[model samples]
Target: MAARILIVDDDPIQRRLLEEAVKRFGHEAVTADGGEAGLATLAAARGDFQLMILDLVMPDLDGMAVLERLAKAGETLPVIVQTSRGSIDTVVGAMRAGAFDFIVKPVNHERLAVSIQNALKISALEGEIRRARRPAQSGLGFRDIITKSPEMARVLRLGERAATSGIPILIEGESGVGKELVARAIQGASDRRTKPFVTVNCGAIPENLVQSTLFGHEKGAFTGAVDRHTGKFQEAHTGTLFLDEVGELPLDVQVQLLRAIQEGEIEPVGARRSQKVDFRLISATNRRLLDMVKEGRFREDLYYRLNVYPIFVPPLRDRREDIPLLVEHFVSRFAAEEGKRRITGIRPDAVAMLSAFNWPGNIRQLENAVFRAVILCDGGELTVDEFPQIAAQTGHVSAIRRVEGNDAPPPAEPVIIESTLPPVATEDGLIGVAVSSGAGNDPAPFGFLRSLADDGHVRALVAIEEEMIRLAIDHYGGRMAEVARRLGIGRSTLYRKLKEYGLADGDDDDAGVAAE
Candidate 1:
């Protein structure tokens, strides 16, 4: 991969030289004027940039300060600091602040290239190690999924049911919504728990190789086929085969897939006959297969075979309740992995800030955010400083109470209070709060939300939906874009509701909504 490197320096000449040197090494370079600008660039990139080359001495936001900020926020991006001969002692400080390597000024192009190579090598190795360790987690059924939301609870219930039967499961969700996690949970909890679990990313493989990847190929099956290869299907025999992004399969491959599902056999390339193989099928996708079928891009027979037991995983924005639990879980895991033992908890404002924004990338994005934050974190508790990109977005922090250990989650039931206003709390050893939604000061009893009416009956769906929309609008200060995002709906959908319920257009965001 061509690494995107951020070159931070005060001197324009130095920046230009470094950029040229990076291009010569076949890597992309992004230059920042100073340390402050460097930090801003990092925030804007959202983990796209892989490495940094920092100038040790700068008038504005010195290199040391940049490293400190990066270390505190759990930023794992490798840093290679460049300094002058006179500033040798400061190089040690930079190292302690998370600099991957250091080089002297009047840059030796060879030395800079070697340092860059080592930094990229180590970064790639770290990522590889993380992936190697994932299997260690899939063995633990349902425990690996961190969630407190009812939306997720429903998913889990469906997964548990699927585990008991031999039905083919089709898990639908936006990318990064943990569809694979749910698949693993089903396999782990099933009768085939000890059997091999083979996974294939249909989207990642080249079209020509998809057939050979899914079905074993005989030696000399095609050019570059020097050795017999056991494809994913044979490897998954008598166990489970998880085909991720299954919708990406070519039309021809879909026919074979449908055959395999119906007959429990797969034909490898250059094979004389199809071989019988028994395996549980669990497929996942971020696309609408029905629509694809209607568009004649997918085989209708294959779609029905896969959609027998459909389970929809809600996106992160729709399940804000899960963010705190997931944050705490990731903190505990990444802190140990990264050796940041001092970091134990996250600030309530930080949790609130995380909860307030709609994560378009879902859990994967949030996980990356927290990983970066943990590396950037400077203290025991993570703060907004650690999440600069998310903090830059329109969000607010609701004051909350932290419990013992600053690590335990608060009670689920909201404690009612006679306070002037309600406090929304998102906590895990962080903030706690009591909400008040009562009328006429009769010591109104309220939970995080109201489920029952004054007449002791369940509330109507329309009333609940309207209330949720209004609360989202109020919480986001009428920034309709934000309100729509946090509510997990489109701007157009939010506009329709505002008109339907006669809600005020906060900030007159209607112009933007209308354009949408």
Candidate 2:
């Protein structure tokens, strides 16, 4: 492959000779008059050139000074130092300053070609090493993830395979899509399962403290360094270091991070010596690192280093089929945690409602919904009444279908059940009953209640009082005096009925109503 070469020599004649010689050897060359000009060229090109040729002696900004600038700027382009005859000391110094190789004046074309070839080969090998190391394709540990969607299944399969590999892993997904969960599963499945799993939220740390937080700092490193602190890298030694929101790391911190990954060591703030750390890297980011790199907000080299094993966790909407399973799992888990033995499972109508929502917050949002529903559940099953936010959007009543088997389909139609509805005043100023499910031709009140309708036994008085009380309170915004006036009963009677129906506290009242 043709490589771009930069030649920096003070002698115009020597520079022209070197450029012509490299061009003939199947390489492109750009020349600079002096060391300062060479650096200026590199800075303007910004890593465009692959290799550089530098003459040791220069009037200004000597070769050693140029090498120092490259080191300070974190430029890794290979360099071939040129030295004059009897300048053995300068040649040795050039090598110590990080030159790829050295050549004497009146350079041999064959030796120059050989040196270039060897440098290119080493660079190629490093590139291959970056792309070669990958995790096994299977045997993932995903105990906490409950999913039935094919999309999620594929994600888990890939994650499992990546878990066994020792290379760095990059997980990408929207917030709440379980990126950290995937990271944990990968770590759990890895050989270092018994080792420490240290997690750091890169975006959460204060910008000024990010470096000290990741690389640690000795006492008196800065204003807040009253005590010595170990960094995440050292803490996760021989283990896994999960950097969530890694894309949010500042550019300066990205440089430090690249050095740590490339050299396997970190120099703590205010510490003279660097410490070696052995840790597996697993980074997660919601933002696209490629986009950031293009925008110059993220380092391209660091992006490549962290993206050895890429895994993407699909969002909840993309895998809607898994919602039911997730709901059931969360219900069971939260039920035991909340010590609610009667909360067996969610109703089919409630599940349908839940499955219909496009959970923008993903799995975490779903888990919170299930937990909240479990707390509100009064019967053995979680019904639509428990999930007001979902129910409000759906605008439907609970059909009360028992959870049949583990994977029963949702009910096709909602079952109408009469509940206590508020009373509305008639034209003649008398109380009237407004049927919640619309009036039916059966003419029998409380007909939908199987318990009350059995054997033609309609508990008319009890049902009327319940219905009247409910409607009155709802109509008058839960004002007991007005509810009593509308129902033609006293406030004492309204309170008595409310207590009898377990609505005394008015906690179960609809949010649209105001309680006095």
Candidate with best lDDT: 1
Error of 2 at 288 (Å): 1.4
Off by over 4 Å in 1: 1-138, 395-516
Question: What's model 2's lDDT at 22?
Answer: 91
Q: Against the true structure, what is each candidate's TM-score?
A: 0.53, 0.51
* lDDT per residue as tens, model 2, 1-516: 356799999999999999999998767899999988999998887455779999888998888999998989878788998878537777788888989999988899899998987775555444334323322222225744666678877888887888778888899999999998788778878898778888999999999999989999999988979999999999999989999999999999999999999999999999999999999999999999999999999999999999988888889989887887678667766776687856656776577777777899999999998888899888888976677665433323322221111123334442233447554433322232322332221221222221122122333677655655655554566676677777787766666677787766665343323444
How much is the lDDT of residue 230 in candidate 1? 94
Give the least accurate 10-residue stretch of model 1, judged by summed lDDT: 395-404
Cα RMSD (angstroms) for every candidate in the order listed:
21.2, 28.1
**Deviation of model 2 at 365, angstroms:** 0.4
Put down candidate 1 lDDT per residue, 1-516, tens digits, no spaces.
246799999999999999999999867899999999999999987666779999988999888899999989888899999888546567677788899998888999999988997786567557446545656654547744767788998999999989998899999999999999899889989998888898899999999999999998999989999999998999999999999999999999999899899899999998888899999999999999999999999998899999999999999999987887678667766876898867756776577677777899999999999999999888877886677566434221122222112223334553333344544333321232333332221112222344445343445888778767755654556677887777789887877777777764564455755644
Backbone clashes under 3 angstroms, per model:
17, 7
